[model samples]
Structure formats: C-alpha cells, structure tokens
Target: MKPRLAETPVLLGWAEAPLSPWSRFGDDEWLLDIRTAGRRADQNRISWAVELPEGAVISRTAWRGLHQAAKQFLWSMTTNPPTGRQRLSPSSVHNKSSALKTMIRWMALDGLETFSSIDAGAVERLRAWLLVRPGYKAKSITANTVVNYMIVLKDLYRQRAKLDDAPLADPLPHETTYEAAGLTPATRGSIPFIPDAIAISLLNTALQWVEEHGQTIVRAETIRREAWALGLTRGARRQCSYHARKALRRANLIGPAGEALLGAYAVRHAANHLVEACYIVIAGFVGMRVSEILSMETGAVDYHPIGETGVAQAYLVARLFKTVDQHGGRVERWIAPEPVVKAVELLEQLSASLREASGRRELFLVKNTQYGEIVPVTQMHIGWRVNDFARHVGVPMHEGKPWAFSSHQFRKTFARFIARRDRSQLFGLAEHFKHASVAMTARGYVGSDFDLRQLIDHESRAETATALDRILLSDRLAGRMGERIVVGNARFRGRAGEQVRRDYIEFVLTETDLRIHACDYGWCVFQAETSRCGGEEGPSEAGRSPSVCLSCANLVIEPRHAPYWRDRRDRNSDLLSRANTMTAAVLTEAIEQCDTVLNRVGEHDEQV
Candidate 1:
C-alpha cells in the first residue's frame, strides 16, 4: 500500500482569502491555519468543517483526509458554489454541518471506517438506525427528519464523486427510494385556525380592557409599600397625646395610600391583560405572522395618501423571513384596519420602557425585571402569555380541553374570516399572506368550520322566503276583481289567498325543479322540466328579453315588485312623449310591455 501523507492538503486559504471584505474575521488572516494545535481555525472558530479521517477506512490517515476534504467542500459551497446554485445561507450551512457530524458519528458506531466501505447496504443500515434512534426528549425520529439526513449524505457523496476522491461506485441510494422507506410522506402539516367564537371573545375582551385602561399599567408596589410603612408606624404609636397626634397622621396617610394602592393594583392587572390582548388583536386582525409581528420597528406604522386622493391609508411594513429572493431579505406590507392601528399604537406605548432602556426599536420587547434588561420577545414568551390570558379570561374548553391558542392560529383565522365574508377576496388575501399562489392560500388558510353547513342552509332558506313573499302579494294581482283566479291546477281566491301563498312556498321549497329568479321586469317562476320559455336556451333567445318575463306564462308579480314596474312604465311614458317618429314605435312597444305586467298583477288601472 502507498504510504499516507502525515498531513492533509488545505484546499482553500480560509485565512488568506476572505469570503468578502465584510467577513467577520479581519486582515490578521495568519492567525488562522488548518494544522494549528489546540483548536484548528476551521474546526473551532470561523468554519463549520470538522476534522475527519483521510482514507476510505477508519485509520488515523483516513480521518485526516476526510476532514480536509469535507472542509474544502463546505468552503467552496459557501463562497463559490457551482453554477446555477446560490451560496447557502448561514442557517442552511449550520444544518448541513450538523447533519454531516451526525452521519460520521453513526459511521463510527457501525465499525465502518473507510469511505469505500460505505456501500448501499451501509447506507440502508444507517437509515434503519436513524429511524429507531431516540431524538430530543427520547422521541422516535420523524420521517421528514430521516429524509433530511439522507439528503445530506447524498450531497456529500455527489461532491466526492465530482472530485474523484472516494472509491465507492454508488455512495447513496436514489432519493425517491430512500425517502419512500420512511413512515410518512414529507409535507407541511395543516395550519390550525382558532374557532370563530373563541376569536371573537378574545378580541372583545382585549378591546374592552384596552379601552378601560388608557395605555401603560402603573405598578402597585410603590403605593402598596407606602401604605405598609404607614400601617407599621400607626401600630408602633404609644397611647399618649404626642403619640396620639402622630397616630392620627399615620392613620390619615394609610387611608389615602391604601386607596391609591388598590387603584394601582387594578391598573397593573389591566396592563397584564392588555399585553396579550394587544398581541391577539394585531395578529388576528392584521394577519401578520408571529415573526413579522416581533420584527416590527418603532416607526413601522405609517399613513400615506392613497393614489391622488387626499384620503390617508394606514399600513405597516415589517421584515419577512420567508420567501426572500436571491438576497437574504424580504419586506412585507400590510394594510392596517383601525383596530390593528390602535393595537400597534398600544404596543408602542407598552414597549416604550423597554425600547428606551435597550436602545432597540423592536416593537415587542419586554423588560426582564430579574436581569434589569430589556430583551426581544420570543415565541415561547408569546405562547406563555397567550395561555396566561386564556386562563385569566376563562377561555372555554375546546374538545374537552382548555383552548391553547398559538400565534399562527390568529393568522389562519384572519384568512378564514376574509374567505367567509367574500370568497372572491381570497385572491387579495393571498397577497396579504405573501403566498406565492392562490392554491397554496386555499389549501392552508381556508378551512370549513362545524357550523358552516348550517349557516349555508340558513342563508338559502332566507333567500327563498324573500322570493316567495314577493310573488304572493302583488298589487297588480290584488287589483284584479275576481273571487278566484286559476292557473293550471292551482287556484287562488280572495279568502284563500294566504293558504295559496303557503302552498306555493312549500312546493317551491320541496321541489328541486322549481326556482325563483329575479328578472329585469319582475320575478320568474322558471320550472326546468315544464317551462316552455325559450330564454332557458340562452339570454339572447326571444323569451330572454327584459320584457319577455312580463308576458311569459311563468311570470309572477306581487306588491313588492309594483314599484319596479311602475318606475319602468313612467320612464317609458316620458320617452314616448319626447320620441321622434322613428323612436316612437320602440317606445310604444316598451310601454305596452309594462302595461301588460301591471294588468296581470291587477295594477293596470290603479295609477300612471
């Protein structure tokens, strides 16, 4: 066998060649070297690459070789990635570094020392080990997580193949086959939306609390301490004239201090409630992600003129972590409602103390009394506060457990509210959510609630009832003097008018073929299976004209529709009066059509 070199070659000059002028390490590049004792610069300080064996096996020479190769691969990807590929973000690089370390540790455990020994069987065995391996908190590893490990391995081997370094023919299995071995497919989980009732209650309580307390809460400690001091002094007073007078003063001070302390305590309690309330209102109403909400600056909210109109439109601008371009930055703009604007103002006031102390303008900082320092609010902090608020306000049980709200739920709820009000607004909602496509918005944001079906049925019934009322009580029909009027098998008499109306409504509701639709002149009782109207074929057909419904057999008129036909007749009369010989004929025909509709409803001779 050829003797292995004592040291591995350094592929990239990490210290000499700075990735950029603004790199964290300065011009003293000689301070960093690959073979430095104690802690190597690449392994410890500036780089994510770890020292590994050089050869394909577990010998000392192989460890050194692998470590140097891995470091070069990582450095290349970070600064000068292959064409058509961008440099990895810091987070991505960190993830890859961690995954590679885990894979090396797994290889050491399996007694596999060399790169050549890592065949498809070794990779498969590593996959099985990862599947049953205990992860954080001793939970079994997830399928998605296993997939990530496989991807890192595949990338490592592909890089080795490019350099003709490793002896393996196929280092990793096909990605599809590797991923399919996992328990579940890799996909984003469904987003949870808070129940509408719970959302409303939360907002209402929050808004009410904010209104009751102007801005910041005054701590009770100052006033309460004063009151306690006075109480102690009053107790220490002796029973004498001099002491009695002093006791009187102490007692007087105690009463006022006690009242002030109580008031302060109330304000303090209100302040605690307002913190969560403000967050909920802003998150739920504004539809901003938790990260964006936390990233807001002191002056993020602003108002500007909308187009040429002098009317000012309020909006908020915040940093967006997701959906960035090639550059690692994205900004999102949100149109703010009045409630969101007020909530933001309240947050600014609440965070003022923290902002002043830390010299940081982040809108959601909280002062840590223990450390006497202000820190940026985190997801865990928000979660704890939300749960605290929910407990305080007695948030009702959800599925036999107390409702545990999260910040993401607020965003999903906001999307659902927009979709419920007007489905067409979903496209606009997608823009607000910063989603790439409407389909993504629909799948993730739009969800049906338990009461959705009931609500739909209720609205349908209300519309049908309105249509039935309009057709039953036409003034035109009432004007016709007859004991009974007959149409087909149905009969309507003066005494039995109410009964006939009831029967018609029930029939319309029960029969699927019968439909009540509003036409240009009045309502049309179109029966799909029995109607002879030519308009059913197309709108341009002869019976599809506005005047066709006036003379059609399926026409229905009532008092509710009288005003509309009257307006048309009067307009036509005015047009006929001003018409020339050519226009007079058309005007006259329109006038006749209006007259026929009025006469059918018994309103032909009632008025102009």
Candidate 2:
C-alpha cells in the first residue's frame, strides 16, 4: 500500500503545516538542508541551499558598525564641521566625509581580521594602541565612537562561529572620565557662572551708559567690547555678552522698546550697546537658556493676559534644541522677570529702527553693525563672539565661578534666585525649566548654596512630616476611601504585626507617600498571652495551628455595617447616586409587582 500523507496539528486553534524535526550536532555546529520551489530552473523548480557563509555573517556586523560610524560622523560634523574659508553650509558634505573617515578607520582596525582570528587580547590591544596615538589623548573620544567599532566586531564574530542562536562574548572597555560618574567634585559645581547681583549691576551700568549717549553711530565691535567687559565680564565678552545680545534681540528683548529704554545713548555709544544691555537684563533676569532665548520668535512672549498692570512679567515658553539635549529630553520654560520684561520692551522699541533700516518685518532681531545695518546671527555665532569679547574686557576671570556668564548663565541665575525665594516651589521651578528632574537642574545648571538648602529641605523627613500633618487635618483622605474595603497582609505574625504598625505610623507621619492607618493590632499585644487563650485563636486560624488574621481579629470595623446607616452621609451620597441611577428604569416594574402582591393578599383575606 502507498504511504499516507501526515496530518497537520493544530496550533493556537488553527491548523498549520508540520515542521521538520531538527537534528542536533555533537560539536555544537548546526548544518541544515533547506529547500523550496524556484521559478529560475523550470515550471516546477526547486532551490537547494547549504550552510550560511562567513562573509554574510561578517557583513551584518560590518553594516551595524557602519551605521553607528555614520551617525557619529554626522554628530561630529554637526559639532565641528570642517569650514575651510567657505561661505556655504557644508554640513551634508562634511557629514559624508566624516562618516567615510570613521568607516575607513573602523574597517582598518576591526574588519580586516576574520572572526576566528580575533580574541579579547586583540580588542584590548587595539584600545591600548589607540590611546597611545597622537591626538587620541587630546580629547577623549565619545562613547558612541567606540560602540560603533564594537558593533562591527560583534557582528563579524557572531557569523564566524557559524552559530545564529548564541550571543557573541565581547566586552568593550570604556575609558573612565569625569562626566561618567555624573558627579566629579572638581567639576560638579565648577561651571563658569555669574552672580545675579553682579549681572544686575552690569545691566544697570550698560543701560546708564547707553542712555547718556544719544542716537550717535558707534561700531558694533566697540559696543560689544564695552558691553562684554562692563556688563558681563572680560571673559564673557565674546562667549556670553555677544550671544546674550543676539539672543535678546531674537527673544524680542532688544528692539524699539529696548532702544527707547536706553533713549539718551542713541548718539554717544552705538545703539547696539543698548541692545547689548537689553540682552544682559533679559539674560540676568529672565533666566532663559541662551539657546531657548535665541530660538524664540516675536510672539513667544505674551504680556496682554496680565492686562499690562500685573507685576511686569513676560511669559517665556519656547522649544530649544540645546537645552533639550542637556535636560535629558525635555523642553525648557522661562518665566520672564520684571527686568526682563523691561528689557524686552526696550528691544521692541529698537527693532523699529532696525526694521526701517533693513525694510523687513519678519527678521525681528539682528546683529547691529557700525554702518547701522542689522546682520543675522545664530546663537552659536554670538556665543563664540561673546567669548572673544570677554577676553578683551577687563572682567576678572575665575575658574568655577557660577556666572562666568556663559549663554547658559541666565538660566542658572534664574534657577538660583527662585530656589532662594520659596524652596517649596522647586517642582514649579523644575516645571518652568522643563527639566526631567530637579537633580538634573541642580547638577548641570544650578549654582547656589540656597538651592542646595531648599532641595535638602524639600526632601527632608521633618519637613515631610509637617506637610503630612497639614494634609491629614483636612478631610481629603475620608473622601477617598468612602466604601472600599481595604486589606493588609504581612509575612510575619503576632509581634511582627505590632512592631510594623508602630513603625508604619512613625514613617507615614514623617514620609512623603500618602497613606492612612490600615490596622491597630500590636504584634506585642497579640503575641503576649493573647494566643494562649481562645481569643488568640485569631479569625483566620480556621484550618491551621495558627489562624489567618481574618479569623480572630476583633479589630475589624466596617463603617457601613454601623447602625448609623445614614445613606445621606456626604461620603456615601456618591455611591447612593450611582445605585439610584442604575435602578431608575426598573423602579416601575418593581412597584407594579408589589401592588399585584398586595391585591392578591387582600383577596385571600376576604375569602378567609
């Protein structure tokens, strides 16, 4: 008789073709013969294939490495593009070239060797050798770069072992650096930052100087140099002041109002210095990041809602590219202070003259030139320029000063001042800054003893206890647990339960997570002779030597089970409403049944 075809088994309630049994090998090698019909050979053709090749395996690793290398190259290009006396944006070309360079380097190091030929020693030696090379130590290579190389190496080895199921054992060693620990005492708070008071004074002086000089033309370079030294610092001229003004103008802080604010200085010093002063005030007062400030459009700030009478405030809300990266993927919020508002008003006034000269309405702010022309400038351009100007200024340069006044100093200063005012408002400040965590704000940007103090207090046990008392005195908790049954459990019995209750009460009163008392039985009280008597048998001990707590605990208090069954209680009213609504349609039918039963009862009484 002819052999019968095998029946397929059901999988997940559906029939499927039977899978061929796999053969196991002793040496850990998997060899399989896979076949399928092909159209290339004939009308009913079959394709036969053998083992997967090493090249195919290695190619996957190479491709992964190439992808990472390409991204790193793009990042590097964006960060430090090769601009050889060019006026064009070569970002795309530069990224391509950079990717090629990285790929070549990776191929030379990792791809030349076969998977079986490489070992842990090879990887170690490669890193050691790279470290010794010229310029390798100049700047620590980014972790991303090393990761790319390893990805390629891993792919190569994974294929070489001719194994598809197992993972490759390759450990890439990373070089330890100050940034890795997330905190390095030497640099933890050592950022070059400027103090608010000094910044305020600088803004005031610059405004005074600009006001004294009326509409006279002055060189942009001269104005920038003076503003950098007098308003910010010698070191912040190019790095902080230059960018600060540029950002101020971009943020609508240095236009017509800004110019009018420094009205008298229109002629003596360049009008641009007024613009620079406007930037300083906004940067010093608003506490916005340079990038956010730079990326701002004209309408990003609104003053109409306050009816123009509320304490001078500009609502600063904008999306910034740089701050987002630093803040661990979060947007930033800046609440412009009084001085910042005044500064923005001053800038709005100046922008009139700027627009008249440029004959443009869309381009709100621009770099002021000696020729009275406005030149376009981005945050990065102004940042480097300000740094250069700061060096020329006589402002003292000190390492680790919170306000060396980088473009970031404005944000830092704002955070510091608010922390000092009301420490409990940290969450608000964190929300304003668009930071993922207060820790991030504290670590990378914030610099002030007051901020640390406020942070410590916010997280303090004593402070939490006091706050909890205020919350408990209110009726919030009573409303939350209206009719729900609550259960408590613990692995330990008797004495353990009592100790836990005491400890829990202490902790709840002193901690942050909201909780109410769940039980009153003390482990000591239950353990000390209570169990010896029948009372100790506990409600839960129905089947065992020691009953579950439910079996004996007389402490069970069901509020609803109380005789005071006032369904009208404020807490129970909500439940009553829900029940009433659901039974409303069935009410007529229930009433009719009751009337029929009453009539039948009356008829039976008459017969008796």
Candidate 3:
C-alpha cells in the first residue's frame, strides 16, 4: 500500500457530481452497493452505493474467505439426519449464506477485511457506524443482514482465531441482531376442510351409484367378489397360502353357479360399493390404519366365533404397516372384538359365492376385466377408489390433498374411544393399539394438557369416591355386626359382640377406613422417605396390616354374655364385607368408564 492514511479517510460525497455505473454495465451488471451513509435526514446508519470496477475480476481474497466459510457452515448445517433435512437443508444454508454475503458487503463498505480482523472495540464501532448508514431503514435488509453478518463473523472468529481480548467475550454488545427472514412466527395456514362423517356417508352412496352405472357395473361386481373372498378367508398366512394354492389348482374362471347368482343379483347389486363398504368398515370400525387394512391378507383375521351368533368374537393379527425403519420389519399384533367379528362375518357371506369362481387366488380382488387381467387391489387402488367415490358422492375433490378421513385417524379414534371408556386401562389400551408405551400413546394422540389433566383428575376423583364408598360400606357392616342381627340368605355375622363397646365401636369404624388411609399414607411415605433420605431408589415395601375391628376381629363371646352374643358370628358380616368390596369394584368400574369417555372427548376435540 502506498502510505495508507492513519486518520479516518473521507469518502466521495454524492453532491460531488458522480456518474452512473449503470451507464456502461447496465442495471444487472452494476454492482448495487446497498451500503451508504448519511444520505437520509435521519440518524447516522449504513448506506447504499455502486462501486465501478475495471474488468472481469475474480473475487477479492476476503470475499473468497467469507464465501468459503459460508459454504462450509452450510455443509455443516446439512450434515444431519434425513428426518431433519428440511430444517437443515442446503436451501436453508443458501438463505443463511445470502444474508452473510450482505453483511460482508456492509463490512467492505466500512473498510474492513476478514470479519475476524475486527476486535471487540472495532465491532462496537462498526455497529455504531451501521446505525447511521443510509438504506439501513429497510427492515428485511437491516435485521437479517446484520444477524447473518454477526453470526458468520462470530463463527469465523471462533474457528480461525483465538483472542481472549475479543469484545464479544463481554456479557453484551450493542448491535442489530439479524435473524433469517422465515424464522419469525407467522399465522398458521388454515386446516383443509374434508367432508367428515356426512362426506363419508355421501362417498358410500356415490360408490353405490357408480356401481349401478352401466360402464363400471361388471368391474364393480368383480371387485366385490374378490373383496368378499378376502374378507371370508381368515387364517394365518400359511393357511391362506394353502387355500390360495388349492383354489389356483382348481382354476375355475366364473363358474356357472356363480354367473347364475351374479345375473340374479345384477339389478340390485353394485360391487364397487360393496368393496368400498368393506374398506370403510375395516379401516374405520376396526381402527386399522389405511395401509394396514390395505396390505392385510386373508390370513390376518380369525373369523371363527367364540360363542353364539349375537355373542360373537374374532381376533385379527397383522404386521403394523407404517414404521420409522422399513428394515426393522414386521411388528406382529392382534385385536379382538365382537363387532369386528360381525363385520368380517358379513363380508365372508358376500364373498361365499365367488370362492368357487377363482382358482388362481392371486389376491382377493384380482379380475380379468377390460382394464386389465389380474389387478391386485393395492393401496393406490384403494386411495383412487376412495377419491372417486368421494367425487361421485358430489363431495368436492382435490387431486393429491389428503382427506380428513384416513386409515391412521381411525386407529387414533379407536384408541381415543378405549381411553375414553376406561382410563385406568391405559395400559390395556396401549396393548390394544400395539404401542410401546402408554405415555407415548397418550401424549401423541390425546388432547390439550388441561383436558388430559382434567380427565386424570376425574379418574382420581372417581377412584377416591369408590374407596370412600367401600370404607363407608365396611363401616356400616361393622356397625351392624355389633347389633347381632340375622336374616335368611344374608344371615351370617362375625364375632366380638361384647368387646364392641363405644371405644371399640369407634375402633372398628377407624379400621375399615384405615386400609384406605394406609394406601394414601404409604404412597406419601414412600415419596417422602426416598426424597428426604436420599437413599435407595425404586418402590418401597408395603406397610404392615391394620388392627382388626368387630367386623373383622373374629373374637368369641362367652355364654355368660350369651343373650347379647347370640348369632354374633353369623354369615351376615362376611356377606356385608363381600358386598362392600363388590360395591367398590363396581364404583371403580364406573369411574373408569367416565375417565375413558372424557379422554375420548379430548381426542375428538384435538382433531376438531
């Protein structure tokens, strides 16, 4: 450098008659120097300017350094799990890097090189300088430009240089913090409206209508025949495979009897609607996710009834369809319900006539139609049919947008229903849903924290009510035992007639409530003992048994007090105690049902 000036260098003023850089290079080629100072009447801040150059030039060394750091930082950002790719993608990198570039241009306008060259004091000064520059009032350019600049500057300083004297090491510095543009919170997009319950009914109606139409009638029937066969054949894969093999060996395409039945039923039937009905019931009522129901084989369901016709039961076993890891593979689970059994039974009845018609049971719905021969009823086919059915039903349709009705929602709904009915049975619900943890299922699918808390609180209250009721019942029985009353069937009574005086009477009442108190006390005790003592972890042992009362003491009365002791140890006391326990169990069951219903309501509200 030819004797660089030590004093603050003066820059050319716009008042000093400047020529437009755009004259020669045109607007695109003219480097838009967004950095300028004191052009506006307001306070001092960064300003914009256009710098003219001689020829086609490589980037300055400092510029290259900034670009390289940005590229490296970008690469670093992208190097994360694929699941998080959107948040840390190359596109995000580009946005961040672009901001950095603007910042670097500002730095250049301030006559600085390699942001690392600026110490703590210089950074302070540069920030002060930025406040007064013109074009700094532009919000996007000001905020993001400054933020990206500081970030890249800090990162550069951290990696390339170590300076204990850096001003950034201080608690705080006054500078504009620029963040990426999209980082700010904005209004969320409106949730898409899909015709819900009514829409589904309409879709079903439409499918029935489409089946009645001339063009698709035969194809519709063929699909129904196949779907029915699928529904009818319920066993393990091996069983299905064996049956399928046998059917293939027979190879009867449209048997005469089947054709005759089809002709007879043709006017009244719509096969597509029947197939649609099968899916809707399977995917909806059974709570199987769409993929699970679609990929389900004939062997997945066990159609055999556990009991009489109305008291039916069936079990379904299949691998869960959607998983994080495809290779992890095959999560085997089962669901059993009477309603599910009934639905499967109906489907089997419908497909009964077609079993003899197909020898090559490639899949339940494969047909040699005009469209093609032996088409598998895949997920795509199901999705298409559902959409078409929706359209036919006069429900407005979108091409690829997901409808509110999906296979997954059904599963969620099922879990919600079970949770609503029996909250204490969360573990059981977890098992039914084949979830790894009750907490996971609850948190993931359940509603707002307030609602969940209320549900749990309701459950707790119900349980408390039940326990209190039991204690009350037990107290009544103990009090009755003192009277020595006997009756037919409920005749038995326990001992301790004379011993049960005023104090002992109080003692019996106390003992019945004592067990309930003991549990509450033990829970409190264990929590306190472990936390206060800071000793061994995990569950504490049960406390000792409570004192016995007139209801439970089993004390014998002598003949001397025979008049008072008559029939004191009769069966009534034991019967009353049993009754008390049963009442508690029933009350507990009712509470559980209340909990389940509340939880289900919560889930429904969340979806809404």
Tens digits of lDDT, candidate 2, 391-463: 3333344454422346665455454443332223332334444544333444333333344344333334333
Sort by lDDT, best first: 1, 2, 3
**Lowest lDDT block of 10, candidate 1:** 30-39
TM-score of each: 0.54, 0.37, 0.30
Give me the overall lDDT of model 3.
0.37
* Cα-based lDDT for every prediction: 0.55, 0.38, 0.37
Q: Choose 1 or 3, whichever is better by TM-score.
A: 1
Candidate 3 C-alpha lDDT tens digits along 453-553: 44434433333343333322221211112223212112122344333333343463445332111121111111223222221221111212111121122
Best by lDDT: 1
Model 3 residue 131 lDDT score: 47
What lDDT is obtained when candidate 2 is compared to the true structure?
A: 0.38
Top of the candidates by TM-score:
1
Q: What is the C-alpha RMSD of each candidate to the true structure, in Å?
A: 16.9, 25.5, 21.9
The true-versus-predicted C-alpha distance at residue 515 of model 2, in Å, is 24
What digit string (tens of lDDT, one per residue) describes model 1 on residues 1-608? 66333222333243344534344221312122221111112332344334543432355565544444445455556665656777765445555656656776676567665555677888788888888889867998776677777766655555553332443555545546345445443443354667755777776666654544433232222233344455557775332333333433443322111332134344345555677877776776566667667778788788878689687767787766544542324665666656567777777776666687789887777666787677777766787798898878776777788877877777766655543332232324344445443333433322222232333244345445666654454334421111122232234335567788778777767775444544334445554433445544112222354555444555555544556677887998988888899899988888776676566656634422
What order do candidates take by TM-score, descending?
A: 1, 2, 3
List runs of model 2 lying over 4 Å from the truth: 1-170, 173-192, 195-269, 304-313, 320-333, 349-376, 388-393, 399-405, 421-608
Q: What is the lDDT of residue 191 in candidate 2?
A: 37
